[model samples]
Target chain A: MSGNSNATASGAIERLWKPLVARSRSKRALLLMAPLVIFELLIFVAPFLILLRISVSEAGERGTAYAEGTWSADAYANVLTSEVPREVIVHSFTIGLIATAIAVAVGLLYAYAIWRADGFTKSLLLFSVVLPLLTTLVVKTYAFRPLLSPTGTLNSLLESVGLLSTPLEIVPGLAGAIVGQVYIVLPYAVLAIYSVLATMDWQLVEAARDLGASRPRSVLEVVVPQAMPGIIVATVISFAWSVGSYAAPFLLGDDVTFAMRVEGQILRDFQWPTATALSVVMIAAMLVVISALVAVLSRFGGEVEYA
Target chain B: MRRESLETALFRAGYLVVFAFMLLPLAVVVVTSFGASGQIAFPPAEFSLTWYESFFDQTDWLRAFDNSLLVGLGTAVVATILGVTAAFGQEIDDGLVGRLLAPLVLLPMLIPPVIFGVTLLVYFTEFDLQGSYVSLILAHTLWATPLVYFVMRSVFRRFDWQQLDAAHDLGAGPVRSFVHVVLPNVKHGIFVGALLAFIVSLQEFVMALFLSNHTTETIPVVAWNQLRNSLSPMVSVVSTFLILISLGAILLAAAATNLNWLSKQLS
Candidate 1:
């Protein structure tokens, strides 16, 4: 059966390209992809190159943003040595780890629930997730101010329920920042896991159960291994977005994140080189982290077992 | 069996809590939008449209809303075109160009928008195009096109190319086949892609914050400024309105395609 499946897959691949291989070499294929490639080069690639250049350029004179056509490693050196940038980077990574962990864990459970559900319940569960994906990020992040502030709804509810003697300031604090960050990334995380879960065969878990595997044991062995791809995607997304988060930290918390520092450099201090350098360094770090994550996760994703 | 039932009940109760966490903020904003008092109070003391009236009365807010609409529509059209063509080209050819273009297009979505915004700010400043609608639309298009591409790639993957083969076996030419046959089947996917792009541009704030000026400021940017400066109910009204637009777009896209298709693209 496995050999037959492999033959079918190979045949399908051959069929997919038999007609297109000839046309791919024609000018039409180049024409088809040219506009988008050129647009990306001009808009996306060129700007990053410029950002790289600015990162190495010397700080500008009193009136300027950056000194054009001058080379200096001062900005990079400053970023490495300066207390503020170092603190901001650490803070950003901390938030990223925390938010990514929570988002992935909760997202897994939520996706499992949705997958286990049927009919109207399943659709409703899925729709609720996508609804937040479409809503404005800033608006939703800002709403946390009213919902979690010291005198906000959560505190009031807790107090009324006799859970608290006084309202504590959750907003403009670390807790608010994490909650808001998790909220921003949760929908994507759920969707990612659910997408994988939707395609999974439930009988694998049932078979595990029949083999005397406990419920949690069955899920850990059968479900999580299969869902590894989605988990990786969700982790990278939540981590990267949280690390470079702007709206949540800016609106709900007083913590100075890497993004907020970049904003200050550009808008307030006019330190273009520093801001660009900081961004360049963080982007490099993010690439390293994400690559490592994908590498490690794919190892777990290897060799899916058939029931 | 009793143990299984109890476990299922506990799992459901936990799931409902997660669902509430997701919807809490948006529900708060909607509820507060109708608060009659000057302060933002939850479970409003009284219901009224005073803030909604204020939002409409303010010319600056209205102008920002118009700017957001303009940018969103522009992004939708440009992103859909680029995304469809690129996905089509990549799908047909499994070559070096397709491999290269696949990751290159998706790079924008993965990178931090703050970095992208600052880079565009510097890039546009060099060209004296900073704070212009063209700059805002271009920045948004770069961000949004990747989403459309992601969606359409999956759409094209599941596409029945046998139909294209049938058209080719007939007397129809390549272009004619693509126009008459290839496009019709994928039109729903195209519509959903465009709608997704529109929503992305409408909600995007980081890039617009850097690229837009007072005259060209988008609704999210304006809302950010207002949120920073004041806790006005008018912001709530604007948010409520934006939420409605996003919800409506999602419903429309859902109607055009289906939830299953959307979920597949998401992963």
Candidate 2:
């Protein structure tokens, strides 16, 4: 087979080959990438540009709106002055920060467990970390509805355990939002931090232990410091995701984030201007967070390459 | 050493509780789905498959499920193609071109899906393409592509490039060599990429919320609507099915790449 093919190869200067050889090899990558690049620019970038334009445009009593004379900042002004939109922005940030804290705390344990355990335990730990992602966020949060609702699983369990005399109102508020966001962001935290630790040299930690430091001390001094950059990255990932998230707060009945606000403005009020403005604000906030992400990636590319 | 061991034991116990918290919601949901009792109670007095049956009985749930499956499959195929192409492009040109393209390709993942949802909602309304499956699938493809590209890129990076050279030297054309030589080696990446793409599409909610309407609603969208209206046992039944599919996907991913090897793929 090789001999026949080799003969064909050696004598392959055919009528169909001249231009192909001249132009094909060098332009192969460019051709391969053309479709994806075009799709992104059209479907992703163009829409965002449109969103920006739409924010300045008006939304009338009838339907979608366009600018009348020049671009207007009325939508922005309304959002700033309005009670709901302004509070949504601040509340989302607060939830994001809280969610980031919870994610880091739980995620650190999961990462540590994965890093320490060897065989089956490691996979189990890994499984727990990733299992939340397996189901939709809505489904998980929906399940939480029962547990956080009156006479639900959590209340029943707590009551049966003699811990509570009255049912706790854990759902449909900021606390529920935090719990839901934590559930969503925890995996990301584990993944981000674990990705860094996976590439890290373990010899240093062992050396610290050998030099008479306790395990906790050694970890605090050696492991935590080395993994700090990753922790920061993980924190930012969780925070950004939470801030930009719609599902968690929406499901928890705390649908007051800028993301959810955009949806609400569109669906409820049919007000494209206010929604677009809120979207722009959300994108701006995300951009700020993303810049932080970019900064970390640039400074610590080697640490998070696999992530 | 004794004190440190005690600390380690305490941590183990703490993590046990944390993991329990992790599993609690899912367990409660699953358990309740099989219960005979009404009103979303815990530790049921009896067990039944009433909810699962009711889920099948409803046409709305079935239609939404069908739409979800259709869109998920479409997104998976589209994302995998784009991902494979981008991965190939990166492999072929690992210079400034690759570096420049990386962030742009990764833009969908970096930015929030809600942002894309909002942008597309407005854009679609403008272009008169609103509420179409094509529009929704395209939006989801944007979300799923980056993951596939990353997975495939890693798989390609770890392969031996010499095998391809050998195939070429043996007189195979580029396409033939890639099919006969490279494809076999990278099948795992393809498998993982496809499954990851599928899962992303299956579980996607935000984009579908903005893009889909009555006819084209995905499962997550339907579930969200149902949850907003009332807590039905059918939601659990549907969620349970999704969880089962996710399990299948994970097992498939594990089979595609060696579990231990893939576990440390992040490293």
Candidate 3:
């Protein structure tokens, strides 16, 4: 009877200690996460807040300190009403749309090919796609300058072949910018779409074939629908990236896009208030695009099932 | 049978064309790097290593390379340490604090880097941290930590806690159990994350452009300035070197980790 009583007492102590141990474990976890949390707060969150505050203030005159008092909507008002600002926004969106569309269309086809190809072809294709992504953006941009220059490869080849009467100017323009942007972003689209393609069950294709569906019909009806979520994600991410991209446009676009305009205002002109306001607009636009993408995906994409 | 044959032929042709489209420009760059004329041209009249030699001769280029190496290595070490610890903490707690903090950690990657750069520029100037190597390292660390966190978080999720508990029950201390049991399990993830951080810091342009002074300009920033101020075939040499470095690192990392498995997981 005394031994039984001792056993019950030990069991009661064990039950009490278990919760304490779990709590301590969680406490240790929180301790681990603190550094990242603090770093983000100090660097990311704080600066963004500062930019937000600056965006509300009015721009000072050239070489004058920006007035720090009386927060107003003047900077935003200027961005909305100004021709340069409006055109920049439109140009940014247009470039983003065209680049994303091309990227997705090409990426979808590429991913499809990769999925059906032999092992060697699959590896080669995958490597080629990711190689550009691994390179520095500055390097890629500089490389594009030579390729797209009037006296560069494409024009030189055309002229040599007697196809062009004159050198075609390609670089330092919107065309060059779009081409460079597309090259940089295409890998992202391919990675996104290929992931979905790889996950799809080949049995579905076989089943459709048995049901008398053509290969193209099977892909359209079954494959495309299944891959829609990934496609949407790819489009959204590519668009967002294009919209905010500075390096390609700055190097290749020759001050043609909104991103370039923003950079110019901040870096060259030192118009902090104007740049801050433009930044806010860019973020708002991105948020809108993302929200719309989420809504559309939720409605039509269903749940993405990966194999 | 005819239809099947035709479909296969079409698919093969399409694949070849797509592959060319994807690789043609980069191939052009590599070929042009060997140009004898030391000018940007598509098909070279002659082949020589003159541009490559010129690249090596420039002192600024060498200094810029050194800067890139230092910044990249620094960011990798610091970010990986912080990211690993944070990932560990989040995994252990799985509490409200972890959930709330998770998105904040990821915000640097998700938000447009322009905003991040500008914000850092303002913040550093405010704190009088501008033009310092420490500031640049800190910025790059913030930029890289998210990638490390993502990698380590997944690693921790797959880790078996029971193993650690077993080690502890067998009379191992907490630190010993971590070093012997947990470290080995997560080593691949940590290595890959560190490699990625290194690569990112090496290639990063926008933030470095704003943050770095003349004395501390990284390879990318120096390249950007060179591109803007003067058109030089020497730029191609630098670009090619950067490409080679990144490719070497990626291949090395792939050899270290099961990249195929990791890519599958990311997908």
Residue A153's lDDT within candidate 3 is 73
For every candidate, give the share of true A-B contacts it also has: 0.63, 0.53, 0.62
Q: What DockQ values do the models have?
A: 0.57, 0.48, 0.51
- What is the overall TM-score of model 3 with all chains considered together? 0.90
lDDT of 2 by residue, A1-307 (tens): 9999987886684543455435445567766776787788888889888888878876565654545444778898988798888888888788887888889877877787788778888778777766676678887777777778657778888999999999988788788888888888787788777877777788888988898877877777777767776787677778778888788888775557877777777777778778888877766876786576557644643332221
Clashing pairs in 3: none
- Candidate of highest TM-score: 1
Model 1 per-residue lDDT at A17: 51
Candidate 1 clashing pairs?
Answer: none
Off by over 4 Å in 1: A1-24, A304-307
Question: Candidate 1 i-RMS (Å)?
Answer: 2.0
Q: Each model's C-alpha lDDT?
A: 0.88, 0.78, 0.79
Candidate 2, B1-267: lDDT as tens digits: 688789988999988887887888788778878877556666566889888777777899899989988998999999999889878877876645456667887666656677788788878887888999999889999988888888888888988988988998999998999899989999988878887788889999989998999999999899889877877677777888888887787778877775544544321
Question: Considering every candidate listed, which one attains the maximal lDDT?
Answer: 1
* Per-candidate RMSD, Å: 8.1, 7.6, 7.9
